[model samples]
Target chain A: MFRHIVLLAWVAEATEEQKAAVEAGLKELPGVIPELLRYEIGPDAGVSPGNFDFAVVADFASVEDYMVYRDHPTHLGVIADVIRPILANRVAAQYSF
Target chain B: MFRHIVLLAWVAEATEEQKAAVEAGLKELPGVIPELLRYEIGPDAGVSPGNFDFAVVADFASVEDYMVYRDHPTHLGVIADVIRPILANRVAAQYSF
Candidate 1:
């Protein structure tokens, strides 16, 4: 399996509405993009102090499938409209098991 | 269930020997630290153009269980002796299922 993990930290000024919008936007991607074999995302539970605000773990069958999801128009739209504006920092990793 | 996700980037100057040691050290943590109910770690597969070098996703029954794993001496030792030295950047998030 190919796994794509993304950790997002929201800007300090990001409002709850904006945060929720981003969360909902990401959670819906799997349904909109057929290449996403599986998707899991949510806000941080605060167990770890000073951690990022959100986490995403998505899976695909191969690197090409992952790239298709990555560059898909709807995914790009989410990044541009919802994610980038309120972002503090982002870190990502792609790995295989 | 509670999940702990960590993304790590090795310093550009870090040697392969050092990176290998860190990977091996982390792979051994779940066996040594009984609090970890599940563990997964691996180097990036390079599908992403720019990304962290390694990823870790570990699971615990609860936040308290996660803390036990976090503060366990074996974990602390690996972080201090292996991870911290080569870490270029780290981003983490904790969340519930």
Candidate 2:
């Protein structure tokens, strides 16, 4: 499977309401994007202190499917609208295993 | 399941040899540590530009098992001896999904 993982930190002023919106926005992606074979996203569980604010894991059958998902309009819209406004720092990695 | 995802960027000075060491070091964990129900680690596939250099995704049966893995001496040694020296930036998220 090809996987994409993202670890992101939130801006200091980001509110609980904004976090909820982020969650709601992310929940919409999988159903709308057919290439996403598996999708899981969540705020940090706080088991380890100083971890990133949130994480996203998505899987695809191949890198081509992942590439399509990367530029899909729906995914970009959520990122530009909901995620970017509150994002402090973010990093993503894609790999096959 | 409980999950941990780490996205890391290597220092500019980090060599290919250092990266190979990191990969070799990570491969040892699954056999010795046993709490990891699943573990996948790799340099980025580069399907997108400007992503983190490496990623690690690990899953456990529960958060408690995750905690054990988190503090395992062998794990800590690898982080300190192998990873920390070459790490430029890193963000990790622990979550349940």
TM-scores, in order shown? 0.93, 0.94
Candidate lDDT scores, in order, read: 0.90, 0.91
- DockQ each candidate and list the results: 0.82, 0.82
Model 2 / residue A31 / CA error / Å: 1.1
Q: What is the C-alpha RMSD of each candidate to the true structure, in Å?
A: 1.4, 1.3
The sequence of per-residue lDDT tens digits that candidate 1 reaches over residues B11-91 is 989999998998898888888888788787889998677899999998899999999888888888999999899889989
DockQ of candidate 2 against the true complex:
0.82
Clashes of each: 0, 0
Interface RMSD of 2: 1.0
Top lDDT hit: 2
Per-residue lDDT tens digits of candidate 1, residues A47-97? 667899999988899989899988989899999999999999989999987
- The clash tally of candidate 1 reads 0
Clashes in model 2: which pairs? none
